[model samples]
Target chain A: MQGGVIALVAEAAGAEALGAARGLDGNAFVVTDLQIAYLALGRIGPVVTSARVLGTGPDGRAGAVVELRDAGAGDRLMTVVNVSGVPAAVLAGSTR
Target chain B: MTSDHPVDRRTHVSDYFRLERWELPSDGGDERPSSFGGRAPIDDHQRGAGGGLRTGGLLTNLDTLGGFTSGLAALPRWIVTTSLLATVSELDHVGPLRFRADVVRRGRSSVVTALDVVDEGAADRHVAAATMTCAILDPRAMVLDFARPFSLAMPPPQADPVRPEEFFCIEPGAGPVTRLRLADQLRNPWGILHGGAVAMLADEAACRAAAAHGADASGPNGLAAADAVLHYLRPVKVGPVEARCQVLGTRAGRTSVRVAIHDVGAEDRMVTLGSVTVLAV
Candidate 1:
């Protein structure tokens, strides 16, 4: 797999994970730095990813870790950690 | 922007950016060695079976295409890549692969270009994306200026270096060092070894080193690259460029590797440097 594609997936997963953690309905974060570790080849199907918030900065920047797995086989495909900038409103739980 | 005449093609906004296309052949035989040092026996398990274009192939194309786009943006001048980073989440090996690139940022002294490898059927879905940073250099400043030499810290050379034929089409060099004899197919439009090719060589070298370091103990498929950063220092115009890689470290299932590229005939003058990280998945 191309690293560029992996980065894009990681970026998307990061945003979703952050949004879910904050109980928001929409994503409003921008990725800054990303690190990914490919674990296995993803079979043809929907890729399942789970994200966890690692930490959050005072300036509304947060770090998260996400894991991507093959939906069909449930084999972990890759792990990604990234930092993103979030809107203050979303971080404060004021925006849905 | 100023125009000399009305209704002139040069004055059109579309004239600032140009689109180009290329076709790369697949079916290149796998020559990659099972591991470095040729100590491990080549087996089916070591050679995982799945045929498509290698990840390196896509990187090669991205480098060339991204560079081309940046050059077009440079216009009346030329630009050279300072660094390139590509992240691929998916793989597509089907033939007649098509992609498009656009100049995302045109600064006074630098140009940033982005490329997307789209699905042949669904044009909106991009399978892969890449970005390149190129430095716009003055034509008159193209002359080489030597910098003070410095020493590099590297591990001792391997006793039984892996052969080149087993990993790449390039000529075999000394132990732990792979060499690529410059050929027409390997050259970019500028008649030099393309940056993507350089990145491929570096990635191969780093991957081999990581594999040799026992990072593949996790499974038989070997370590999959997480990401890579390549910095082009000089152009490779001579034949038989050599690539040397060293395993920097392995921690938390992540292996860090560093690779250096040099011209064999030029007293091993460094031409490129790259760092790659892989997970022992």
Candidate 2:
């Protein structure tokens, strides 16, 4: 797989989690950091991803961690930690 | 019976390694012309209408050449890449690329190799530098599990196939997401996807994300990758891996991006993580 593609996949996972944790409504977000560590090779089928919020910044941004795993055998593939900033509007919405 | 020519058998070490050269293209010349005899250009799509070499392609070439160079020193043993770090200063139309690899440390089980790609015209200036850590595994002691659990289903053949591109291509997916599929050609001899391919994917995603955030607004020179670090967590064996990217921040015309690659089937698992910095040209 290409590194860009992998990054996109990982970013998508993080974005999804960030959306769930804080309803963005219509605010924009920017990524600050992304770190990935590979665990195993996926030789069977499609890989799945999930993410969790690590923390939130005072400015409404958040840090998230995402994981990729084998879909068939459920083997872990990679882990990603992403830090992103959410607009203040989205943060206000979450507080409500 | 000896001829007038005297053989200097001083053990020419350089001959043991393969030498490859890239000739600089003339002004307005095609940087990457079609290799398949007049077929469509191989890098047209990757150029993104800018007509410059993609950063991902450059990294892939660096990784492949570095691996080949390391293999010469690892003789009788296989070298597996554990990690790689690359930094690029410029990647415009500059060419006539040249690279040489040097073994930094040779241990019993692992070796560290440093490779530098430079422009032939300016020998002192480096276009990109990469360091790779490889583990030496005894070939005789290697175990082959041919019966490993691999999917038997194959991807449908391309409708109009031409020569394969050197770097992996990306397709836009749902907002800020990109997708790629694994093919046999992209796999290493061990039947797993090559690590270089993974690096290319990560670099591409990071660059695109940076570009999306107006990182390329500094004239038409385009964004150049300043540095990148890749951590390989596992082997990618499946199809349709997706990549997501986020722009961490920007300062002084440089943008930082964080990217994650995940298996599409398992939306919760990650396959790789990367951090890249791009400077506006």
Best DockQ goes to which candidate? 1
Off by more than 4 A, model 1: A1-96, B1-52, B91-98, B119-126, B138-168, B172-176, B217-220, B223-226, B251-253, B279-281
Candidate 1 lands at a TM-score of 0.53
Assess the local accuracy of residue B212 in candidate 2 as a C-alpha lDDT between 0 and 100: 76
Candidate 2, residue A1: the lDDT equals 47
- Model 1 per-residue lDDT tens digits across residues B251-275: 4445777878998776768998877
lDDT for each residue of candidate 2 in B196-238, tens digit (9 for 90 to 100): 6777677666767777776655657666555677766666777
Candidate 2, backbone clash total: 48
DockQ of every candidate structure: 0.04, 0.02
Q: In DockQ, how does model 1 score against the reference complex?
A: 0.04
TM-score of chain A of each: 0.69, 0.70
